[model samples]
Target: MGIEFTALHWIYVVFIVLIIGFMVKRRDTTLICIVGIFMLAIGATGDFTSSISGVFNSFIYAITELLSTILIISIIVAMSRVMMTSGINEVMVAPFTKIIKTPALAYWTIGLLMMLISWFFWPSPAVALLGAVLLPVAIRAGLPALGVAMAMNLFGHGIALSSDFVIQGAPKLTADAAGIPVGDVVSASIPLVITMGVVTTIVAYIFLRRDMKRGTFLLNTVSEENEDSTQAMEENLLSIGQKRFFAVLIPIAFILDVMAMAVFKLQGGDATALIGGTSVFILLLLSIVAHKSEGLEKTTSYLIQGFQFGFKVFGPVIPIAAFFYLGDVGFIQIIGDHLPATSHGIVNDLGVGLAAVVPLTKEIAVVTLTVVGAITGLDGSGFSGISLAGSVGSLFGNAIGGGTATLTALGQITAIWIGGGTLIPWALIPAAAICNVSPFELARRNLIPVVIGLVVTTIVAMFLI
Candidate 1:
C-alpha cells in the first residue's frame, strides 16, 4: 500500500514549499510557479518539446477550469458597477446602516450571513451575490476591507463549505469512501463543525478588533489614487425612486434564484450559471434604464470594467494555480499519462502513503487523519483527494474497532477547511476579488484562526473517537 514517489511528486512538493515560503515573505511567486510547472512537465514527459508545451497547457487547463468562476465574478462586478454608478448601491445598503452600527456587529453579521448563504449556492456564487451588498456596509460601519474578506472567507468557506449540510456533497464523498452512510458522516460532523466555526470566527474577530484598536487596519479603505472611481459619489442617473426600485428589485431577484435552486435541486455549476445569467440580465437592464440613449455603450463599458478588475485580481493567481494543478488530475491531461499505474494522483498518493506509514492507534488515528487530510488538501480543491481521507479513515477504523464516522468526518472537515478556500490563495480568489483584498493577505489573516480551530477540533475529535 506504500506509494512510490516519483520525480513528478517530489518536484511538486518542492515547488509547493517554495510557493508557501514566497507567500509568507510577501514575495511574488509567479516566476517560481512557472518554473515549477516546467519542472513538473519535464519530470512527467521527459521530452523537451512536450514538456515546454505542458507548461502552457497547464495554464490553459487551469484557466478553463476556473473560467466559470471568473465569468461569474466578472458579471457580478459589472452589475455592481451599474449599481454604484447609478447610486443604487447606496440605497441597497442604507437599511443595514442602522443594524450594523459597529465593526464587531458588522463582522459577526456578515460572517453569519455568508455562512448561511454559502450552504445553498456554494462560496463562489454566495460571494458574488452577497459581497456587493454587504461589503460596503461592513466597511462603512468601521470594519476594514480585509476584515470583511476574512469574515466571508472564514464563515462561508471555512464553516459552511466544510460542513455542506444543505448540499450534503462533502459528506457524500467521504461517506462513500469510508463505506458508511452519508447520514453517519453528517451526524458525526455536526459538533466538530460547530466547534470549528464558532472558535475560528471568534478568534478572527478578536484579532481584527485588536488590529483596529492598534491602528493596524487602514480606516479609510479606499486608496487615494483610485478614490475618484471607487470612493467618490457619482451623479445619479436614476431618480431616487428609480434607485429605490432597483435596490428592492435586485434583492428580490437574487432571492427568487435561491428559491429556484431549492426547487430544482440546483448546485455547483448549475446554480452558478443561474446566478451569473441573472447578473448579466440585471446589468443589461439597469444600464439601459440608467443611460437610456447611451445604454448600449454604457453596458459594454461596465462589462469592460468588470473584466479588467477580474483579470487584475486573478493575474497573480494563475501561475500558482497552474503549478498545483499538476498535483491533481491536471497532471495526466497537461503532461500526458506519466504517473505510476497504481498512482491515484500525486496528492492522494501522498495521503495514502502517510496513512500507510502511520500506526493505527486511536490517538494516532485522529492525528494521522488530520495530517493526511491536510496533505491531500494542498492541491486546493478540498474535494479532489477527500476520498482518500475516507478510505484511510476506514483502514484505521478496523484497528480501533469504532469511531469510523468520527475519523472520516474529521478528515472531511480538515480537508475542506484547508483546501476549500480558507487557506489556499488561488482557491480563495472569489472572496478576495469580491472584497478587493489580496488572496495571500486573506490567507494569512485566516491562518492563525483556522490552525487554532483545527488543533482544538482535532483534540476534541480525540475525545469523540
Candidate 2:
C-alpha cells in the first residue's frame, strides 16, 4: 500500500533536508535534530504536555538503542589500554610490521589486514585491535598517517562493512527489508561489493601515491622516530618477561575467540558480545596482574576512562541518531504503541512515496533505489537504514521488472558504503581516532573515491538486474 503522506511525514522530510544542509555547511545538527524531535512529537501527539515528555523519551530510546554499540567500543578500548600498558599491544603487531618495510607494502598490508579482521570481528573492534600496533609501524615505514587512516577506513568500513560477508549483519538487514532470502542478498552483493571496493580503494590508493610522490603527504610536525621513542618510553615500565607472556597469551586468546566465533557461527551482536566479554576478562586479568592489590582500583579507573571516551564520542551522535531512529518502525514500541496502527514509518513511507511518484523505467528504478539508499545512510548509522533500502529496492524491482536481489544488493552496497563510515564524520571516528586525524578531513578525503565507486557500482548493478 502507498503512504498517505501525513503532516508528520512531511515534517520529517523537511527536517531531514535541513539536517543534510547543516551537514554540508559543516555545522552541528544535534540541536536541530533535538528540536525536530520535539516538533515531531508535538505533531504526533497533538498535546503540548505529552510532546514535552516525548523529547526526553526519544533521547532515552536513542541511547538504549545505541548502548550496546557504545559499550562494546568502550570495553574494547579498555582492553586495548591494558594491552598497551603491558606492551603486549606492540608485541602483537611487531612481527607483522617487519614485512611492511616499504611504504607501498605498509599501505596494502594494513589495508588487507584491516579488511580481514573487520570481516570477522567487525570494524570498530578491529580498529582497537590494530590501531596501536599497525599505525606506528605504518608511520615508520613511510606511509603517511593519513594514508594509514584511509587504508583502514576504506578497507574496513568501506569494503568489509559494505559486504559484511563473514558476519552477515548487513546482508540480513537488506534481505529482511527486501523480502528475500539472506543468501540471495549476500550472493547478489558479491560482484557489486567487489566492484565498489576495488574501484574506491584503487582510486584512493592512486591519490595517496601521487601525493607521496609529490611530497604533499609527508608527515608533518611529528617525526616518526620521536613518536616511536615517546611510546617506547611510556611503555618501558613493563618487564620484558611480563610483556612477552601477555603478548603470547593475548594473541592466543584472540585466536581462540576467532575460533569460537567460527565454531558457534556467531556474527553481529553475538560475536561482538563474545569479544566484549573476553576483552573485559583480559582487562581484569591484566589489571590484577599489574597492580596486584590495587588491581580493582585500576580496573575501575580504566573502565571509567573508557566510558568517558566512549560517551564523549557518542554525545554528538545521540541526538542525530534520535532524529533518524524515528524514521524506522523499530522505534514505535519505544515511542508508544497506542498510536493509530495505520501510521507508517517515516523512511518506509518515503520509500513508498518514491515508488508511487517516480516513473518506473529500468534506469530510473536503479538510480532511484541508489539515491534512496544513500538518503537512508545520512543517519550515520549504516546498519539502521539498510532495511529501508532493501524495502525500497524490493518496491522498485517489483515496479520496474528487475531482479529483486540485484536491486536489494545495490541498495545495500550504497547504504553501507556511505553510512558504514567512509564519508560520514561520526561513522569515521573510530578510524580517525586511531590515526590521529580529523574525522571531517578523513571524510573529505573519502568523498571522491566513494562517489566514484557508487557510480561504478550502480552501473554494474543495472547490468546485474
| Distance from true location, Cα of 369 in model 1, Å | 9.3
User: How far is 384's C-alpha from truth in model 1 (Å)?
Assistant: 16
Score every model by TM-score.
0.65, 0.76
lDDT of 1 by residue, 313-367 (tens): 4565566556666666667888888999988777667656655666557889899
Off by over 4 Å in 2: 1-5, 116-149, 160-193, 207-237, 337-346, 361-448, 463-465
By lDDT, the best candidate is: 1
What TM-score, to 2 decimals, does candidate 1 have? 0.65
Give the range of the ten consecutive residues with the poorest summed lDDT in model 2. 221-230
Cα distance off (Å), candidate 1, residue 445: 11
Best by TM-score: 2
Candidate 1 has an lDDT of 0.77
TM-score of 2: 0.76
Model 2: residue 326 alpha-carbon error in angstroms: 2.8
Span of 10 residues, lowest total lDDT, candidate 1: 222-231
